[model samples]
Target: MDPWLSMYDFTYHLAQEIAEKIHERNRYLRNGENPVKINLSVRTLLKRLEESIGQLRDSLLRSVSTRQITQLEGDRRQTLIDELLTKERQLQMSFKGDGTEPDVIRSSLMSGGGAGPSPYNPWVLEEPEETRGLGIGDLKQQQQRMIREQDAGLDALSNIIARQKQMGYDIGNELDEHNEIIDDLTNLVENTDTKVRNQTRHVKLVDKKSGSCAMMVVIVLLLIAIVVVAVWPSN
Candidate 1:
């Protein structure tokens, strides 16, 4: 098999796989099943698909670099690339919402009602209600509901932040009060230490004066005793 043909087939099958996965996801949503599993599976599949597309693009570039494709083959390869791009667009539209209705409605709204379906997009002519399995009105309603949910989430987050801010302020005030109390206690301790030192000095001075007075009293008593002995010398 030609390398280009092999690459084309790979891309074509990968696109089909993505489309089928989209359908599966839609079915899960319709059934009101837990979307977590489906979402995880879809995400994994999409990653693989993107990697495969990159590989395909690189392979085409390598062929061109090697001058492997004839002029006719080059044109065919270009057509294949176009088809892959279309499929990729379709896959993206499917992921955005209930298939392509959102994109179609958006384009129509943007064009101011002057836009018609293009010949290249045959799927665009198909009734969106049928293809997407939902009316445009329903799609709009879903979008509005999603917006309301998002608004509610934002409000909740804002409330939480406000509460946290208030708590932070309260904590800061408490810390400041504690610091002030610590400073006051420190000053009180220093004043007490100074008073204690002054009292110790005063006590030591009083003790020295008492000792000097005792020595003077002893000297006076000795002089009186000597005088009495001299006056009684006749005995």
Candidate 2:
């Protein structure tokens, strides 16, 4: 297959594979329970898909010279692939079976410029331990800070879902409005076409009638002139 075709095919398959992995993870779970194992499995598959996407992109770029590829529609595809690869790298650093510290992961995220949770595995549910702090005031301050961070993360996820819903609704409404306008225009054009045909027929009828009348008038005048000459016995 052609390099561009292969790139497109790889992208399609990658998306399909991601979707399948997500579905598989969901199927293994029951109710609202969060399965850390399933989440990790899905993440691992996602990582592989990212790798495949990177390979596809690199292959495409290598096959097509930069001058030829720059103006190609694949420019957007390549950019998106780069972004996914970057996210995958960050995820690998944070969640890979290395048991990295959350603080280190957070620092890595800040420096690496990746979004979402800290590179540390958030799904790792650890039991709470007794805090032997110096004062109650300090403990309360820490609790409030943690609550604020959780709230911020929830708000961000909520906003993303809401925006996607709004975009879908907007597209649906635009398509309906466009179809309505097309229907109305189609009707108007048909009616106008019918009216034009009727006018053309009417004009042809009037021309035929006028021509018949002119011919009759000419014949009558000639007969009258012949009668006058016959009665006067003209030289």
Q: Local distance difference test, per candidate? A: 0.69, 0.62
Q: List the candidates' TM-scores in order.
A: 0.49, 0.37
* Residues 1-235, model 1: lDDT tens digits: 9766786787667666666666666655554455677667767766776777777778777887788877677667776776666566656666667533444543432332235644443222333453366654666677788899999999999999999999999999999999999999999999999999999999999999999999999999998999988897784
Cα lDDT tens digits for candidate 2, 13-72:
554454444433432332234557766775877767676776877766774565555546
Q: Residue 232: error of model 2 in Å?
A: 2.1
TM-score for candidate 1, residues paired by index: 0.49
lDDT of 1: 0.69
Q: How many clashes in candidate 1?
A: 0
RMSD of 1: 14.2
